[model samples]
Target: MTAALNIYDPSAKPTAGPRSLAGLTRPQMLEAMKSAGVEDRKAKMRAEQVWRWVHHHGVTDFEAMTNIAKDQRGSLAKAFTLARPEIVERLVSVDGTRKYLIRLAPGVECETVYIPDVGKSGALCVSSQVGCTLNCTFCHTGTQKLVRNLTAQEIAAQVIIARDDLEEWPTSAENRKITNIVFMGMGEPLYNLDAVSDSIDIMSDGDGMAIGRRRMTVSTSGVVPKIQELGTRTRAMLAISLHATNDDLRDVLVPLNKKYPIAELMDAIRAYPGLNNSNRVTFEYVMLKGVNDSPAEARALVQLLKGVPSKINLIPFNPWPGSPYECSDWETIETFAEIVNRAGYASPIRTPRGRDIFAACGQLKSESERLRASARKG
Candidate 1:
């Protein structure tokens, strides 16, 4: 008979504070177990059980892991935490969208949005970094400086927190309110691709969160180098934040275009893995009045995506405080869509959800920086 494992060291003080295992990958969890003094032989098995409890059940307490031996559970508890980050604010829009302002560290914060009726069910848009490096001129998050790339754990925690609030626990395929996820919240996901890749592994694990890879879409403002690598690693759908049809206009709107111009971006889109009629890349074009919304520009867009498997998502520019751009008139948007639609591509006008509460697309700036600015003014 095998001896019961007791890996606890009452006299051993931790080198660092206990970190929550809520969103760590299985390999990460196993490493955490070993650090907790779990025998290497026992760490793997223990990690799988705890991973299920943390992800599938969304449990916040080791005591709730009923299958584990009581003393062993106490040992795990001493080694790690299951607590969630502090939610600074939870704002809900009249249109049934929910926005969460999560404080990751003392000064590091990010915003996540839950929008209903997106895709087969609904979608949660999560950030991969504290702020953005791409100063996409029309976006609120661009106004904030890049603090740091979020770790894999931090990125996954956004989904974990959203799931907790929606009361959508136990990881059932049925009754899932958030059927899809978009990396369109605050950060440029490709800039933090390693963490994003690890997070997808955790979120898609069959015994845990179980969100399918196809249902996760990562939007980028033309980070050309990482495009193919993102597809190969995560296998998530790709969405391009291509606001303007021409090079000069795109350079003004998305400044990153200066770095990775439209031609390079288009080439990358063409070579994205698994791109077919069924698995299409989405081009997100924000329609700005009198800027990139002309019918001629629409024709140019058709030419841009000429031979690619793609659908264009026409986002009516969501306005923020002192934003320079105005949304294109409805008729203008329709005419532009008509031109693209005529070219045998689907051009869906994205509904501006959570606009009333400033939770809509291109409007996700966390309160941390805003508060700091106010303090400077004070």
Candidate 2:
């Protein structure tokens, strides 16, 4: 009998080059099909048929598409591939959070996380860049220098990988493990907005993966220029990584605030295409020990978001090795949240998931592959 899939297998390797059609958008699929010598009239129809199999059902092999004829499948296979990246390691947290160290190319890696019991069902936090450009002081990922931006296909492949592991094939509304997608992983998503936007289109297409745009939230560390454009293009929910209330504190906590201060950031948020109670912008506030988590600060947060509909996610700082911060005292966090709760906003002290596995918020780093290389050399 075959051995069970080793979720933690370290020898996993990537399918090199741009041959994989698994993460292509609908239009991209059409282009690939035409390039594969699919006749002009038949290309559109064939692309649609194969799109369902690749995305809706998460089929890796063209042969599995029984709806398409054998001869065409052979042609398609010769033209392109549908291979997933190397899952260098998969770690599962006791709390049901799953972290994946995925290698997209040689020397290019990023982490994707699936947190269970979030939103309606669960959320997959996918990285947009290899490391990070925004060095938010409290975040562990911020400590790593930026490697590069992930391609549209590379970004979408994270979802594809999660779906494969979860065995959530043939997308359905019920019994779904990942009902939402959050761009709150290793990188500042806005830095790679174009790929982030295209990947959203691929995953959210009703004819394909079918997760709604509203359920896919892109969290940015306040990229003022792209905030409105991101809303206009993707219609995905906007989440600002606004850790502190004022410019001075925010500058220290989120250094990007120095370039685009709280006032400017808020202005961009307020002008976000569809601002209302129904579609409130999320403000992620990481509560650090004796740092930004004060009752007065919470009140100021309420005032800062006076007119705009907002949900403040008060995250208790998840510490990392040699990190410069500690989580706020439980009572201090509760007190801070209480002030925001008194306001007309939803302020939930985000329960730390995957802290034991280093999969919690702002804790993701993709050094596992390097560690594996060192062990191999030894």
Per-model lDDT: 0.88, 0.86
TM-score of each: 0.95, 0.93
TM-score, candidate 2, is 0.93
Off by over 4 Å in 1: 1-16
The residue ranges of model 2 lying beyond 4 angstroms of the native Cα positions read: 1-18, 368-378
- The digit string of per-residue lDDT tens for model 1 on 1-378 reads 221112212122224688778788788788888888888898889988899999999999899999889999999888789988789999999999999999987788999999999888899999988888888899999999988777788888999999999999988857699989899988888887878888899898889988999999999998898898889998999999998888898999999898889999889888898899988999999999989999899998998888899999999999998799999999999999999999999999999999998898899999878889889989
* TM-score of candidate 1 on Cα atoms, chains taken together: 0.95
lDDT of 2: 0.86
Location of the lowest summed lDDT over 10 successive residues in candidate 2: 1-10
Q: Which candidate should be chosen as best, given lDDT against the real structure? A: 1
**What's the CA error at residue 81 for candidate 2, in Å?**
1.7
What would the per-residue lDDT of candidate 2 be over residues 1-378, giving only the tens digit for each residue?
Answer: 221111221122235543787888777788878878889999999999988889898998889999998998898888778899889989999999999999887888999999999989999999988878778889888877877777788888999999999999988747899999999998778777778888999999998889999999999888888888899999999998998888888999999898888988899999999878999999999999988888888898999999999999999999987789999999999898888888878999899999998999988888754476469989
